[model samples]
Target: MAGRVVRPRQLAFALSHTESLTRDNFLEGPSNETALALIDSWPDWPNRIMLLSGPEGSGKSHLATIWAEQAGARAISAHSLIDTMVPDTLVTGALVIEDLIPGTFDERALFHLMNMAREDEAYVLITARVAPASFAIPLRDLNSRLRAVPVVTVAAPDDQLFRALIVKLCSDRQMTVDESLVSYLATRIERSVAAARRVVAELDAESLRLRRPVTRALAVEVLRDSA
Candidate 1:
C-alpha cells in the first residue's frame, strides 16, 4: 500500500526524566566528601544550626532536599521568615533556609527564629554560596548567631566527580553516553554541574536533530555552544 509512514507511540522519546534524588545518586569525591559526611552526620552535628555553603549548582539543593525529606523539614526563604505564620512553620523542628543573604534578611525575624529554634531544640540548615563568616551583616545579635553557626563547604567537583556528573546528567536524560566522550568533556570543561548539564542537554538535542550518535566532533561543536 502506498501510504505515509507513521511513527508509533511506543518509540516516543522522553522529553523529560525523573531525577532520582537519592544519596547514591550524589557523586561523592574529595571535593565534597567532607560536606557529604557532615550532612550524613546530622543530628550528631556539633551545632544544631549549621550552614551548608557551596558554589552554585554544586548539588547543595539536592543535598538540602535529601536532608529535608529525612528530617521532616520545611524549606523557607528569607522573606518568608517575616510572615506571621513563621512561628507555626518553626514548630516543624527542622528548617532549610535556602539562599540566605545576610544583609538582605530580616534581622529581627531571623533573631527570633533562631531563639525559637534553640528553645524548641530545632535544627536549621542554611544553604548559601558563601560561608556564614563572609556575610556582611551589621545586626549584632543576628550576625553573632550566624558567625557561630558551623559551616560545611562543598568545593567545586574534582575530575572524578566531574566525570561522574557527566554520566549522571546523561543518565538523567535517558541517554547512554560513551565513556570516551565523558572523559573528554570532563577534562576539557570546567568543573561545574551547570556547565555539564548545558553541554549534555545541547549534545542530546543536536544528536537527535541530526539522527547521529554523540561523537567527538559533535561534542566539540556543542561544547562551544555550552560555553
Candidate 2:
C-alpha cells in the first residue's frame, strides 16, 4: 500500500539553523547573566530540563540553540511534534523544544514525553514566550510540575546590549554601522532586543536596495516609514 503524504500547515514561527553560535553571537548584559551561566554550565545532570521564556527578540532561541550546540544537543519545534508520528524516544541527544506553551494542553502526552527524556538521560530544553503557568493545563498538575522545573527568564535587552547586538549582527553580515547611527537607534527605537533586530535586518535589505551604506538618516527614514 502506498502511504499518503500530507503537508502540514505553515507555522508562523521561524527558526534559523544556518547561523553559527559564537561569543560574538551572544550579547553580554546583567539581564542575561543567569541564563548565560546556565548555558555556560549546561548538561548539569539528573534532570536536564531548562525553560527559556521571554518576549520575541530577547534572544531566547539564539541562546537556546547555542546551549544545545554546547551540549551536543538537538533542537526541535513543538509544532513538528504534533505533526509527526514518531515516538519521543527516537529523538536522541539533548533536545530543545521551541514554543512549548502549545504543548501544555496535552498533559498525558507531554508528561509522558518528559518522563521518557528523563529516563533516557537526554536533555530537554523548552522555550516559550509565556511561562507554563499561563498555559491551558489542568491547574494543579501544571502548577506543581512548573514549580518543580528550573525556569530561566530572558529579560528584554537593555540599550547597551541592544546596541552591541545590532553592531555584532551588522558585522556578521559584513556591513558597517556608524557610531552616530548606533547611538540614534539605541535611543529612538522600541526598547527591545527584537526591535533592534528588525531594524538592523531592514537596514540590510535597504542597503542592498539603495546601494549605499546604512546611515543614521537611512535608519530614521526606514523606521519612521515603518511606524
- Poorest 10 consecutive residues by lDDT, candidate 1: 8-17
lDDT of each: 0.82, 0.73
Question: What is candidate 1's CA lDDT for residue 2?
Answer: 100
lDDT per residue for candidate 1 within 79-133, as digits (tens), equals: 6578465688777799989888766778788888888889899999888889878
Instruction: Please give, for residues 1-227, the per-residue lDDT of candidate 2 as tens digits.
Output: 99999977443333232344565567779788878878887666434777888888787888887877777666766655642322543366577777876544445555666666667767878888888766666646645676577788889887778888778777766778889999998888887867776787888777776767889999888988899
Regions more than 4 Å wrong, model 1: 1-14
Clashing pairs for model 1 are: none
Q: lDDT for model 2, please.
A: 0.73
- Alpha-carbon deviation at 70 in model 1, angstroms: 1.5
- Cα-based TM-score, every candidate: 0.86, 0.81
Query: Against the true structure, whose TM-score is highest?
Result: 1
